[model samples]
Target chain A: MLAKRIIPCLDVKDGKTVKGVQFVNFRDAGDPVELGKQYSELGADELVYLDITASHEGRKTFTELVQRIAAEVSIPFTVGGGIHELSDVERLLAAGADKVSINSSAIRRPELISEIAARFGVQECVCAIDARLEDDGQWRCYLNGGRIPTERTLFEWAHEAQERGAGEILFTSMNHDGSKQGFAIDALRRLHEELSIPVIASGGAGTKQHFLDVFQQAHVDAALAASVFHFNEIPMAELKQFLADEGVVVRQTCK
Target chain B: MVAIVKYNAGNIYSVFCACKRLGYEPVITDDPELLRSADKVIFPGVGEARAAMEYLNATGLADVIRSLKQPVLGICIGMQLMCRHSEEGDVDCLGIFDAPVERFRPTSAVDKVPQMGWNTVSANGASDKNCLFEGVADGAYVYYVHSYRVPVCADTIATTDYCGEYSAALHKGNFYATQFHPEKSGSVGEQILKNFLAL
Candidate 1:
């Protein structure tokens, strides 16, 4: 059986983990590579390093960080954020990333998805969508990290991305995030229904039950949480054991 | 030294890194001489069937690989290409194994086309002799991300149940192939690679 994936996402700025990863016992808390290795030991199914760096030198550092992680960590990982063109995609994948995620660049130029998928295959391209359920009851997609809203709605853009050859969709809900409530189940379910590719539920993960709700109710292929896993609020091994007891198929740490 | 077959496929860096992690010196090369003379050859790929076969034929790697006397391991599309044919591009692949690759038909809502993430691989009954699975538990979890599959055959040493029983890894003489990525499969994968290196 295909086990549902559990992913821990990290925010990287200048090749360092921006958010306070309070739970890590590693010597250097800001080093993304060390944190990633720690997560792998703790049984993370996959890892995503969202590079928020903008400067050219910072991008180079991110690439270097990717190589270090790939060489040291034994699991697969996806690099996202600041990926604009095919060259950027090529650089990261060449640097040993299993996959690359794109957001605002894909929305600005939809063809970027096709270009990456054509050269590197669909499995290598991850389309990340940041949207918010606003007034008037529409899920409006956002850009620039949920600061600016786009005219494209959630479902419409996701369908287009799938058509344009995105193998997976990482949907982050702005309204439900930081509420300590749960994943945006309704929107995630709709995305899975409307698209054939895998859907990764992000944002609003507070408890072990939240993870179970997303996988059981929304039927998403994977669920990603940042702060909870980082803060050790919900340990991965215990969570997987709980989900398994609840009849949810999760990849347990190998014996 | 280990030689990794390089073709038009995307980066084979992960495979190289995996070898290095195992304390082996590996090189990514398309040279026929290096691949033929290496202690072992790793055929890793991530691309379409037709294009990959085309590149192999163009570079004469198809013949070079078929003629290898040492153990050769194939990963993902590399495994599919080792079969007789593939439904991906209706292309005829190298006939190393008797198995044929077919596309996965989405039977249910949850059966995603690309069977991504981790899944279990169980050693077949007679697979006790195949050292590639040495020290590895039956029904071990490994990472997989592919759409096409090869049905269980005489050469299938291990099977994984996604929609149904499919050949997860096939062993025939000196050729070994895995449908999943051992390099990306963590410790279990490392053990499998160690077993392969022991050959």
Candidate 2:
């Protein structure tokens, strides 16, 4: 059985985690390595570090940050944001990332996914899609921190991503961003019904029941949250226990 | 000294890092002489079994590994390749253990194919003391990410439930294999490595 995953996403800017209420009004949270180690100790299924900074700072700092976090935590870590090519993937893997996520690069050159998949295997490649619900009731693909919209539709992009050999799809809803109402259940249901690859549902998880709704109703493999976890609105172990009570098979923390 | 067999697998760095954490310097190489001369050999892999076996046979490390008399530990695909045969490539294995690796068949309503994430293990009663599960509890959870699994056999030291009861840890004389990745499994995983090192 594939156990449901609980991932805490940390957005790093200038090597410091900056959490916002709704992708705006940023506030300094803590250090990346310290937060990663804390999450590992708290039994997080996985940790995702996204470099939210878009400056021309040298790559040395980000690679060093990855190394520092990998040294502190023994669990699987994924690094994303600013990965442009095979060399970027190689650098992060060499720096100790278990997986590399590509978003805008993948959108620009879909072949990059296949190339990386062939070299490092599909399990190492994760395709992140940020989709926003259009006024016409269609999901449009967004990139560059949900600032730009591509002409591609969600289903088309997801199917092509899988065809290009992505092991998993990380789907984040723009409309649900920091809404905390719940996940975009309709979009998730459509993706789960369409694609065979493992789908990780992100964005808009306000309460414990929201997680339950996503896991039970949406049938997503993993659920990711940022503010909820960073602000300690919900304890991970307790959430796992709650899911377990709901008959969802989650990785229980060793007592 | 610890020698980790390097055959283009993904998890070699984690294994090397784990050794460093244990106060031991491990050499990652595919050379036969270095592997045979090491106090213990760590066979770590994260790719397909056929390709790994192909690399071993091409490098002539297959014969060296089969003839090694010291303790040897196989991790993940390394463990799968130690069996009689693997379904991944229909390739013959090292035959260190009498078991055969089979693709997981999802019978229940749950999803099929890759069985990822963590699960608990229940030890077999044959051994009063388990070498890998020394400090680990009976139902402790360990991280796993694989599609195929080895069937339970007489050599199984610990069993975990996924699609069904599968071999979590297997032992035959001095040869040991684990389907889970101890290097990525946190504190309990570290203790398992410590037990392996203490051996």
Candidate 3:
């Protein structure tokens, strides 16, 4: 059985971890490599580094940081933000990222999925969909970090992303994001039922129960969070232990 | 010195880092002479089988890899290429393990193809005595990300069940391979690599 992953997302700006990181041991919140090392040591199944502003200069810094994180953190990690082309994926993979998450670029050019999957294996590409619940009772996809909304619905685009060659679908509900209410369980279950590939449920994880809820109720392959892990509200090792006690299959050993 | 085969593959850097963490600075090279004289050879890859094999054949590393007498370890696509043949691109492989690679044909939609994330691996056959496992537990969770799988055969030393039971690790003579990425498999993985290095 594949263990359900608990991933801590690091929001990178100018190559440093930003927003809601407070580890007493590490004084530097902006240092992604430091925070990432901490998380991996705590037994977080994986880490996701999302470069919010992936400018040309930022790309260089992010790549360098990826190399550092790759060396220090032995666990697998996924890099996202500013990944527009196959070359970008190649650079990051060459730098040592286990996978690359494509969001806005994939929304703009759906074929980019197949292009990267062709050049680098499909397992290397992760299609991240930031979806907002619309008034019409449908979930619409968003771009530019949820600033611009697209006509594509969550189910339609996610299914297409898989058909195009995405190995996993990372669904983040804008409504549930940062609300700390829990995962968008209903939407997560819907997406889980729709796609054959593994689905990673993101957004609105305040407590350990949130992880347990998604793993038990929605049956997501993985659960991701930022502030919950970064702010130390839910330490990865404790959260994983809590989930394991709840009978969720999680990696127990953390060094 | 340990030498890692450098070919048209991905994530060789992480392998280098893993070895470095274990206090061995592995030499990443495609030169057959360097590969043969090394204390150990690590055949690691994360790319398409046809392209990778083509590069090995073109660079003459294919012959070098097959002829290496030292302890050799292949990973992911590297392990697939060591098989007799692969259904992926209908390509022939190095034929070291005499196993065939088959694409994951999930019987139902609920069964995922790539089988990504951590899964438990158990010792199989006489390979339970294989030193590669060493201090690793019987059902240690190792990282896996692959769509193609090698069916259970006589050479299979370790097995993991995803859509079905498949060879997670194979050993024959001095050659050993694993479908999982020990470099990215956390502490259990580090110990496995340490065990391999000690061999």
Candidate 4:
């Protein structure tokens, strides 16, 4: 059986992790490679590093950081944020990123998904959707890291992105994000039932139960969290053990 | 020297990085001579079979790859292409292995087409002694991401059951292939690579 994945997402800014990620063992959250290594050791199945800083110099630093992490960390890692063109995708892949996640750029130009999928295969491209539930009981998609709103609905955009050759969908509920309440279970389940590709649930992960609920109830392929892992609030190894004891299948690793 | 066959496939850089992590500076090349003369050749792939074969054939690397005398390891699509044929696009592949690749048919809704994530892989028959698996414990988890798979057959060395029992690793003489990516599989992966390098 394929094990459910536990991913630790790092929001990078100005060449350092900007999410106030302070590990108990490692005081500094700035070094991506060190943090990535620690997460991998703690049983993180994958890592997602989003370069929130969209500057040319920031990109250079992100690429260098990816190279350093790739050398030491054995698990797969993804690089996202500011990926607009095919060359951007190519550059990241060449820099040693296992996959590339596109959010605002993909929403603006859906064709970019097929282009990258055609060039680098579908499995390498991930479509990340930031969404918020409106009063109409419908989820509306957002752009620019949830600061801007779009007319497109979450279901419609997710469907289009998959047809355009996105291998997986990373759905983040803006309402749930940073709330530490939990994931948007109903929304995630609806998306999972609709899409043929794998659906990853992000945003609003407060406890190990949150991960369990998303995986068992929502049926998401993976669960991603940031601050909880960064601040050592939930030790990754302990979380996996908790999930495993709760009857969720996860990859067991040697520390 | 370790040479990774460069045929416009995906995840080639990850393979290169894995080699570098093991303290060997590998070269990525498409030149037939370079691939043939290397101590070991790693054929990494993550692209369409038809297009990849087209590139290999056009560049004459296909013939060179088939004739290489050194130990050649194929990863993911690289492993599929080594088979007699693939149903992905009804394209013919290098007939190094006797099996054929088939697209996975999900038995249920939860059985995703592209089985992505970590899964335990166990050796079959004498594969426990197969140099590629040396120092690797049985049932160790390895990372795999693929939509199509080669059914179990004579060349099957290690097996992983996802949807069904399929070829996780295949060995026939000097040619070895794995549907899983050892480079992306962490510690168990590093051990597998070290075993391959020692070979």
Candidate 5:
């Protein structure tokens, strides 16, 4: 049976680990490599290192950091943020990153999705959509780390991304992210219902029950969180136990 | 030293790292001499079948791979290309195993095409047990990410259920193939790698 995945997203900035509240007020977390190694040991199914750094030098550093993590850690990981073209994807994959998540640039040039899928199998490109629920009760996709809004709604963009050869959709609810209340259950349920590709739910994971809610209610392929796992609010093993006891099929790592 | 056969594929870096983690200085090469002489050869691939076949045939490593007498392990697309044929590109494969590869046409809407994430593998009746899964438990979880799969056949040593039962692992003579990524499978995968190294 295919088990639901648990991914710890490490937001990397300036070659160090950091997490911001709603994409602002960033604070130092720790070294990304160390944090990744810890997560791998503590039973993280996969890791996502979002390179929040935008500078040219920052990308170079992130690529080098990818090599270090790949060499030391024994698990799959996805690298995102600052990937603008095929060359960026090539460099990151060459650096040993398994998958590359594309956001703003992909929205700017939708062809980037197909290009990546064609060159490197479709399974390698993850289309990450940062969306927020608007006043009209529609989820609007955002760009530039949720700074700017796009005309494409969450469902439409996710459907187009799937048609364009994206392996999966990483939908982050801007309204629920950092809120720690729970996941955007209703929006996520509709998104997965519409798209054929696997959907990885992200943004607001406050408790272990939230993981259960997203998986049971929405049937997402994976659930990802940053602060909950990073700050030791919910340990990976204990959470996995909670989910397993509650009857969610998650991969249990040996202690 | 173990040799990781390299062609026009994406990310053999993790395979190299996995071998390094097992304390072997595996060489990534298309050079026939290195691959032919190595203690073990791991043909790891992640790309389209037609292009990969072209690269293998062009470099003449395809024939060399067929002649390798030592244990050879194929992963994901590596396992696909080792089969008789693939529906992916409608191309002929290495024919190391008699099985043919087919693209997944999932019937249920909920069952995704590219089956991603961790899944369990059970030892079937292919043999009492495949040596590759010596220490690994039956129904042990491993990571997988692919769009194509091989249906159950006589060569199937292990089977996994997606939409239905498929050959998760196969063995024929000296060649071994898996539809999952053991390098990224964490502890269970580490044990499988240790068993392969012992072989």
Candidate 6:
């Protein structure tokens, strides 16, 4: 059986891994390469590096960090944030990043996704949608780390993203992020119901049981977290064991 | 030298990347002369079967691959195309492995397609401590992404379950393959590639 994935996300700024409380008041964590190496050895299924400073720096530091980390770890890693054009995709690929994720830049230039997918293939392009529920009980897509709202609905953009050749959809619920309550099962369920591509559920992981809930109830392909993993709330090996205990299939470390 | 038969596949770079990690630079080519002369051959793909077969037939590499005497390893679609037939394209395959590839049915309550992510592999009884699975335990997880699977057969060297049991890896004589993407599967994946290189 295909086991569900557990991914640890790292926010990269100027080639360093950083974390913040709900995407603000950032603090340095450690070297990107070193942290990635640690997580890889700890049985992290895959790693996601978001360039939080891409829009401000006018260049992506995540690309260089990906090169550094790729040299250290053998697993596949995805680089996102500030990816604006086809050349950016090319640069990330050349830097050894296995996949390129697009968010704000993707909304600003929708054709960028199609162009990159056409050139590099859909498997290499992951569309990261940061969404939040509106007062009307509808999910609206947000960009720029969930600060900017787009007119498109979450499902609409997701369908468009898939049609434009996105291999996977990385969805993070802004309302649930860092709350440690649980994943937004409704949002994940909606995406899983609508899209054919692999859906990676991100944001709001409070406990090992939360992973089981997401996998069992929502049927997501993967679950990604930052604070919980960074603070050592859940060790990858132990979590895998917990999931296994719960009858959720997971990858065990080679003994 | 090892030659990775390059058609229009998605995971080609990762295989070349894996070979590099294993300390050997494999030539990614479809050239007949280069492929025929290489010490080992790696056939890899990540796309629809019909298009892949079309590329193979168009390039004349199909004939070249069938006649090769050296060991050949296939990955994902590469493995599926080596079987007797595939429902994916309704086309005849390389017939190296006596099996058929079928698309996964949407019967699971899970609602997930492609069966993406990592899963464990149990060595088949016929496996003889082969190098390809060295450092990989019977249930160690490997990365996979596909909607179709190869059914159980005599050549099955390993098996995995998704919806139901399916061949995760296979070997017969000089031919071998894995439905999983070893190149993207972390250290365990690297070890599999290393084992293949050592063989």
What does chain B score (TM) in every candidate?
0.97, 0.96, 0.97, 0.97, 0.97, 0.95
lDDT by residue for model 6 (A95-120), tens: 77778889988888888888976766
Residues A1-255, candidate 1, lDDT per residue (tens digit)? 888999999999998999997874568879998899888988999999999988999999999999999998999999998899999998999899999999999999999999998888888989999999989999999999998889999999999999998989999999988887999999999998878899999999999999999998999999999999888899999999999999998878753
Candidate 3 Cα deviation (angstroms), residue A117:
0.2
Q: What lDDT score goes with residue B155 in model 6? A: 86
- CAPRI-wise, candidate 5 is high
Give the lowest summed-lDDT range of ten residues in model 5 chain B: B121-130
For residue A147, give model 1's deviation from the true position in Å: 1.5
Q: Provide C-alpha RMSD values for all models, in order.
A: 1.1, 3.3, 1.4, 1.3, 2.9, 4.0
Tell me how far the alpha carbon of residue B49 in candidate 1 is from the true structure, in angstroms, after superposition: 1.0
Error of 1 at A71 (Å): 0.5
DockQ-best of 3 and 5? 5
lDDT of 5 by residue, A1-255 (tens): 899999999989889888632312223336788778778888899999999887889988999999998998888999999998999999999999999999999999999999999999899999999998999999998999999999989988888899999998999999999999999999889888888899999988999989999999999999999988877788899999999999999988778
Q: How well is each residue in B67-181 modelled by candidate 1, as lDDT tens digits?
A: 9989999999999999999998899999999989999877787788788899998884663647888887887789998989999999998899877889999999999999999
lDDT of candidate 6 at residue B151, scale 0 to 100: 87
* Model 5 chain A weakest 10-residue run by lDDT: A20-29
- List the candidate 1 regions with Cα displacement exceeding 4 Å: B127-129
Alpha-carbon shift of residue B91 in model 1 (angstroms)? 0.8
TM-score of each: 0.98, 0.91, 0.97, 0.97, 0.97, 0.86
Ranking by lDDT: 1, 3, 4, 5, 2, 6
Q: Give Cα distance to truth, residue B40, candidate 3, Å.
A: 0.8
Top candidate on DockQ is 5
DockQ of 3: 0.82
lDDT accuracy of residue A38 in candidate 4: 83
Give the Å error, residue B46, model 4.
1.4
Tens-place lDDT per residue, model 2, A1-255, is 457889999988888878742212323236788778777877788889998777758466788898887666888878998999999898888777888889988998999999987777667888999999899988999878888999988889999998887878999999997999999998887787777667889999999999999988888888999889887788878898999999997877675
Per-prediction DockQ:
0.81, 0.45, 0.82, 0.78, 0.85, 0.41
lDDT of 2 by residue, B1-199 (tens): 8999988667688788877877899999888889989998999777778878888888888888888888899999989988999998799999999989998886753452466566776664546658777878777777887778998898999888877888998998889889998887888788888898889
